[model samples]
Target: MSENNHAYTLSDGTSILDLPKVSLHDHLDGGLRPATIIELGSEIGLELPASDADALGAWFAEKSNSGSLVEYLKTFDLTTAVMQTSAGLERVAREFVQDLGADGVVYGEIRWAPEQHLGSGLSLDQTVEAVQSGIEQGIADVRAAGRPIRVGQLVTAMRHNDRGLEIAELAVRHRDNGVVGFDIAGPEAGFLPSKHRAAFDYLATEFFPATVHAGEADGLDSIRSALLDGRALRLGHGVRIAEDIVIERQDDENTYVTLGTLAQWVKDREIALETSPTSNLQTGAIAAWGDELIDHPFDLLYQLGFRVTVNTDNRLMSGTTLTRELSILADAFAYDRTDLEVFQLNAAASAFLPLEEREELADIISAGFEGS
Candidate 1:
């Protein structure tokens, strides 16, 4: 409501946070409250960069803006460190949903690698249960507060590790519980999705959905592998798909463009691009395009008919929310509420939920935008 507390407002004096949104590629370990991290870190006797919340938040932002994906990922080490136990995982997951609900997110997919949370002697199943319990509690909390929100876990496997097959199975095992999809995160350039072909193959056989982290730290080839090898239903930060598009000619009246085979396939298939504006800028994912948000190819991809969805990949690290990400895009591209609503609908359509459920989410979003 108030600008002091909310991250964004439109020119019409509308709080962007009041709009219903869908988050397709949000990270669980990356959205913890600073205070929660401090408390959890203390309980585990873990050393933190800053003992206080504000300072710790600043530390995360600073590290994330280092313009290196690898360095940006280092910030997660601290967050995941505190989330090594059931209590820690539950609290983090609970707060994650509460924060999403507060941000006006009607539905969100919280992605985190379970392989990274085993430091406290917890099995993969136990970790999944802990997070699911937190998610249920968080949903109840939001409903009690007169807000309706839905969330699903995108159980992730670190790409650099060899536990992809294991993590994939864990996700499928919990499909009926809270896990809705699977994802592969970590270094993207060298570790192609093909490296986890076995896992993707298994997921394919089981008819499970997956979204691969691609075209952020790498290029078209990586994306190619993600589609062919990972069988990804969506591309996490697939902004770099722009690289495959060539502007053949530009004049005052028109800009002629051509899409490469890879780009053509992606656009034709309507694979969603989980582009996080702030996080992309912070990690230099859009560096090839340009330095500032205005230079991001998100608009190009959007205009070119890509199923682009807005996201806060790492809310805490980027110091952003879904509202803030949309506001930034609106500011840079002069988008209206209709444009914002389309992004939400895109996310809803691309969600790993069943067709009827996705349609329901789309209806909810369309209704909200109409009322607004």
Candidate 2:
């Protein structure tokens, strides 16, 4: 069961929440518990649109489902406001891990932009330390509860901002700490990864990894820049890449398809697509395909071997858990345990970990699924 008790049992009565999973594209600030937000906001004398946790959660969900990426982002103003202090940031991070653990995530990468949390007096490094402290405490809490879990930070740089180089340096500086990788997130259409060339170059020189937000709020041109300019190893919410694929003809037995040049490169390289299904529908990322999850190109990408990984980009805003994400996909596609296991394995392969560790994670997942 998830933290919300969203029990998703498979056909064989195997609970999805009991399966060891890997989360590669969750956001730290986006996963805050609604009760925590109310408490933190009260402590900071912040005005919340909703006075109660349930109401606040519903409010976020309602706002995020507005079918516009711009409107979907307005809810973050409140979340970021409450996280301006070190204590708030640490507490949020700790609870975020607890929630992930409860949802059966063996490993997760929590991404957030340090620049957004600096509204208070803390410096850049201070924010990183605060989040790391919370992650350690959360890991301890999960272990104390007898569930093994591991988590790392992916420091993000808002694409609309000019702090890409500075945030990149901050991420590299804290690589030995809890920070594991780098990313650029935020309104994706107007702000191409090319604008952050200097930062990408710096990270490349340092041999650091990155996952850029593309193919969600933007098109193939944006994805091209993410690969060539940002040098991203993975793409965040890369559902739009389906736009580049052309189905020449479909018959009862075979569906002939042709991949565009850029799509072919991404597929050939096995670059992971960090796809968030519900969020994609809400943000209209897959409107070009259809308005429903069944219409999503996830199955198309998976059947064609695109290294697609499932993720919950924003839990609170979407009112979802990783468990729920998998459950919905399972329900939509009539997926069996084998299909679910494949998604988890794909995520394990794409995690920001060493080759040996990723293999170890894969072994854990395989073992867990077998027992399930």
Candidate 3:
């Protein structure tokens, strides 16, 4: 679909930015404010490509949209470079939550690899605790400001690294504090979840939830490993699972399709697909299907009854918010308030929260949609 200048508004003029939303796959390190990055970089004696915040923001956007994952990841190196200390981590995490609250996210799961943040001699446990402290502070600040926001930590293990088990243990240790689940992120092509099978097995044995970054930079095999080996409850940017679906016929109102075994399992089991529209387009995650947002398999997966949820995988890198993502999707797919509510319901159902809290979130979403 053609990009619309006024993409994020409802036909009747409802502002998408005002809608209560849930973010499932956002990265803590990838959502830092440009000004924060500059200040933190300066504090650490690190020279940035751009001395100014706006210029640095533009630089991040440019590198991310360059159609290369390697280049896109290089931007993270800068962000993480400033996040090695407790103060840096705490401030960034707090700001991340505040930004999410401002973006109308009622709840968000912030994922980051603790191992990557240990360059400052902080232990893994210390890093997780620091982030949790920041998250708690952010929540208190949001509540103090009369806004209701809840955030959870999705402790991540870099798939290429050998500390998966250590990270998994760390996530489990903090489960009662702020950690809600475990995840494996990083280069998704060669670093299969199977490589971290020991960690996944350990998490499974402990009954901890896990999500895997699959089907983005990789294909169905990677997704298969995530589900089978990683026991992923959700697929991080699982946009490529569409590759397994065979579209047989299409009419103006209906499309007939056949699903492969993997797609069938993911759909029938209600596995959540965390689809980030702008990030997917920028990273070429949906390139095989098409280049535009409208070409994304999100609609296809949703139509087939897969638990598809909208997300901002990396807000800073993508230069987007969840509101903008949903707005663009609404414009591209002709979605309405009902459609948006359904997405929220799907996300609420798939949240790592307890059943009662998930129900509460669903109720909140229903009430909000009805009021709108």
* Model 3 lDDT tens row, 190-304: 8999999999999999999999999999999999999999999999989899999999999999999999999999999999999999999998899898889988999988888
lDDT (Cα, tens digit) per residue for candidate 2, span 193-305: 99999999999999999999999999999999999999999999898999999999999988789999999999999899999999999999999989999999999999999
Each candidate: what lDDT? 0.92, 0.92, 0.90
What's the residue-level lDDT of 138 in candidate 3?
91
Candidate ranking under lDDT, highest first, comes to 2, 1, 3
Angstrom error of the Cα, residue 234, model 2: value is 0.2
Clashing pairs in 1: none
Clashing pairs in 2: none
Residue runs of model 2 more than 4 Å from their true location after superposition: 1-6
Looking at model 2, how many pairs of residues clash?
Answer: 0
**Candidate 1 vs candidate 3, lDDT winner:** 1
Query: Ten residues in a row with the worst lDDT in model 3?
Result: 1-10
CA lDDT, candidate 1, residue 287: 92
What are the root-mean-square deviations of the candidates from the true structure over C-alphas? 1.4, 1.3, 2.4
User: Candidate 1 residues 1-372, lDDT tens each?
Assistant: 113436477777667888999999889999999999999888878899898888888889988999999999989988999899999999999989998898898999999999898987999999999999999999999888988799999999999999999999999999999999999999997999999999999999999999999999999999999999999889999999999999999899776899999999999999999999999999899998799999999988888789999999998999888898999899999998989999999999999999999999999999988877
